[model samples]
Target: MQTAVLSSRSLRIALPLAAALTLVACAPMSTMYSQDSLPDAVKVPAGNKVVLQTVGVGEILYECRAKKDMPGQFEWTFVGPDAVLKDRSGMQVGRYYGPPATWESSDGSKVTGAQVAVAPAGTGNIPHQLVKANPATGMGAMTQTTYIQRVATKSGVAPADRCDMGSAGAKQKVGYQADYIFWKAS
Candidate 1:
């Protein structure tokens, strides 16, 4: 029987390389979006780090509210969001909501971003989009987010229910799923 030993030089180089590869594989991120295909206005500037990626599973809440144009009527108006952001492994990480979509990490870091561009999805599906985040709001994991891209959406829109949409104060909730990629200025 013969035994082989890895040289010190080889081991030094191979260990770190192997560890890096393992970490990358464990990250579980899929289909990283590149800047080349995104609109200039929505693109994240070069040198930003992709800090986190999650699946936002929740509702695009709507409320039956007054559509003042008509004499006496109401319509379903977008009311903000109610979602739980989860990791690729399906672990809950945080939440998303707001007038400007906000992503908050479990550690209290958060970023509020606005839609800048969209790529049309098929009929009955919502479009994917790039959102530009505002300046950091806190000193935590989420505070660094400078950009976000929502992709791989499954469902988001509420059904065209015949229920009287004009019923004031009536609320509706629809399930939605999308990939939320968070970027930070490095």
Candidate 2:
């Protein structure tokens, strides 16, 4: 009787442990951050791999101004962006801003990039974008970045308020969020 009881207890513990291990082993190899499902226009170029990822939470500033080359017409033009960059755990890791579109790490490293491509995200959301990074400054997480992809965007579109002559010179702030994936040459 004693031997049977011991065996039963051992089996109970071992069975769950084995099942957990099996489930872990069968889990997919890919991480949650894979760019494979993104639009082709926003994909990082071949030979590049993701080095860092962050969530940008902030607002975009738009200024009402006369439309270029369209006399007597006016519109709201993008002035710039101001956002705080945070890691997956929600820790503030850096900032993103400026007319030049700069990404700066908490460690003082930073990079500016030129727009490479953009794809429509959806109604009421900003477009997904790919940027070709310039050389880094100050050396850190941003140093090795060769490209940046903005994905999973939410609610960054321009304000719907009128931009006609009456609304000209007015500024509007629109909140938005996006996942920024930094890539480097493989």
Please report the candidate that would top lDDT against the real structure: 2
Worst 10 residues of 1 by lDDT: 1-10
TM-score of 2: 0.82
- TM agreement with the true structure for every prediction: 0.70, 0.82
lDDT of 2 by residue, 1-186 (tens): 999999999999999999998777554322346766888888887898877888999999999999999999998899999999987767788999998899999999999999999999999999999999999999798997999999999998988998999888999999999999889898
lDDT of 2: 0.90
lDDT string, candidate 1, 1-186, tens digits = 123345766788999999998787677566465657544554566888787889999888877776768756656777777789998878788899875677887887778876888886556666778888887676876775778988777877655764354466777887888888888777
Q: Pick the candidate with the highest TM-score.
A: 2
Off by over 4 Å in 1: 1-47, 66-74, 163-166
- lDDT over C-alpha atoms for residue 145 of model 1: 72
